[model samples]
Target: MHNILSVSELSKTYDSRFQALKRINLDIRRGEIFALLGPNGAGKTTLISIICGIVKASEGSVRVDGHDIVADYRAARAMIGLVPQELTTDAFESVWATVSFSRGLFGKPANPAYIEKILRELSLWNKKDSKIITLSGGMKRRLLIAKALSHEPEILFLDEPTAGVDVNLRRDMWQLVRSLQATGVTIILTTHYIDEAEEMADRIGVISKGEIILVDEKAELMRKLGKKQMTLQLQTTLERIPPALAAYQLELASDGNELIYTFDAQGERTGIVALLKELNDADIVFKDLHTTQSSLEDIFVSLVKEEK
Candidate 1:
């Protein structure tokens, strides 16, 4: 995993009063889907804006493909494609024309074949001649992606790419992202959809209050923070946890129909065997039993709350 983008002690303060981003340090690996997760106003957008030259950083530095973002603006900006959260585009311009214009903005020569390929890849070929204002919300989102990729950038930044899209469109966008990754394009996306990150990201970074709280491989993060719960359908209703099973820290359901035992999924011993043995000793019987693994959403919420 090569570091294609590097941020060292990056800080952004407005009017020397509001710190939008704390001293943030990050390394975005080449050819990987890195998901940035944060709550609203957590500086996710601010960080991406600085990297894409949309916003100026108050202090520190950012390097895109070993080129300083500010000192080597052309080279750095050329290697990155930013799909902003806002859907601001020339309403009268056709999809094909708009995307082609974006390529020209990067000082790249016109390449009709490349533009055609990008349009087809995003399923925008049929709508290529259609005015931007006439396209559906989903098509507009796809057009944004096409515009970003027009210049053939090495890194693609998707800022809430699927934010307002329908479920089918969102799934299509995920498939499109996967296709882009297959072509060796590194992707860094900031999304409110935790499940989307869990499904698409190779690595996950959690940011809170402008500071990065954790960064880990998606699977590794799940293993480290994920928990498992053993749910027991009790044969008889109980008002509270039995005194005999106090050591296990069992939880009694509100309806008194289930007993829940939670433990770390990565633990050497889950203590289920001991817990069941104790239940047997106490002559407590269960009608049914089931186990469930914690989701990435659970881990994300827990991490953010802990940071707060």
Candidate 2:
């Protein structure tokens, strides 16, 4: 896995103030679905805009597939496609016409067969002749995808790709993204939907306040940042934890009917055996025990809040 896109010391300033982005450095591996997660005003879009050449960075540089975005603007941009959050399509244009023109914009030769393939793949072939305005919200989003793929770009940037779509459509979009990845097309997406990143990303990156907070394999990040909890249902209610069990640092919950123990998920030793033995010596009886691991959403929310 080699990097397909790289941003180094990329900084953006608006009107000499309002630094939308700081000295951000990131590399997106080829053929991986990388999800950029952040809160609003977190500079997710600003970073994407710089990579896609929609906005110029006031400082630093970006490279797309080894070509400098500034020096090789045309060659670099030719390999990328962007599906923005807004539905900024011509209302009167037919689906076929709109998609066809997008490919032409890239200086690619006309290929109706390719256009038809993408349309059918998106379930938009039948609506090819329909006006953009007549299509439903789901259809319009799907149409936007079709247009983005029209030029057969190697790298696709999906900015809030499933914003207002229905559940079924979102499912379809995920399937479609996988299908594209199978073709060796690298995808970089910015999504407010935490589940979308949890469900689709191979690697996840967290950006907060114009800086890159963390980037790691989705599973690794979860394992490293996530906590594991064990809940013990006591046979009898207690007013408070025993003073001798203070070393365990357990919290009494459920009105003292239960106790919660938390530990690192990635730790080699959970100390459960010792804790249980101590509970027995402390005359603490448990009715049952269960454990749970933290989720990506929990980790994400915590990170953003910590940054703030």
Candidate 3:
């Protein structure tokens, strides 16, 4: 569980008026998939840019494997691979040539075997001879990944890697990320897809207004913040909740045909049994009852709203 990256009191401001990041502190563990979730203009990409040395921080410091990103730019940059949200590549260059050029940029000795492995893993081997402009959108995205991985970085930064891709391609990207993790590579990704974060991340961080609101283990975050709702279809119309059942915090539906009970999902006892018994005592009967669990999207929205 070694820390592969650390950021202390990181802040960023542009044009001396707009602050893009705010006092962010984080530690990314080795071989872990950490997902950063936020709305557009929430600084997810700004934070990534600063960490990758694409943008300078207004204050504080960052270290990649103990190498200062600012002071040891070469070593720090060399240890990281970035797949940006935008798809920009040499249009006329062959896929293989472009990826090889990327490795060369890092001053790494030519390793054809490693390059071949990366292309095959990304399903770009067949198109290695094809020009970048000739490939399909999905193939171009895969080529972006192959190029990022060309240098054999210990950490990979994926900024909306699956954005604009089809479902099958997105799934393939997820599998590729898993395979990369198997090789002991640490991954940090910024994504708009909450389900993707829920499915792939070991830990999740929510950011808003250039500030990190919460960071926690994905399951623990869900359990701590998640809420459950029970909807009961009343057999008869009720104008309002009974005074006796008010303690359960029940909400009467507008149509007067349902009662909704909201409660914490992580509670040791949901008190549903007691509520049901009390309902029976009050002569309140329901025709049907259904329950639903809160999703990651729900928790994320709640967190961001609270920050505002």
Q: List CA RMSD, all candidates.
A: 1.4, 1.1, 1.3
Per-residue lDDT tens digits for candidate 3, residues 150-207, read 9999999999999989999999999999999999999999999999999999999999
Ranking by TM-score: 2, 3, 1
What is the per-residue lDDT of model 2 for residues 18-116, given as tens digits with 9 covering 90 to 100? 999999999999999999999999999999998889999999999988899999999999999899997797899999999999999999999999999
Model 1 regions lying over 4 Å from their true place: 268-270
- Count of backbone clashes for each model? 0, 0, 0
Q: Which candidate number would show the highest TM-score if scored against the true structure?
A: 2
lDDT of each: 0.94, 0.93, 0.93
Give each model a TM-score: 0.96, 0.97, 0.96
Q: C-alpha displacement of 67 in model 2, angstroms?
A: 0.7
**CA lDDT for candidate 3:** 0.93
The segments of candidate 3 whose C-alpha lies over 4 angstroms from its true place after superposition are: 268-270
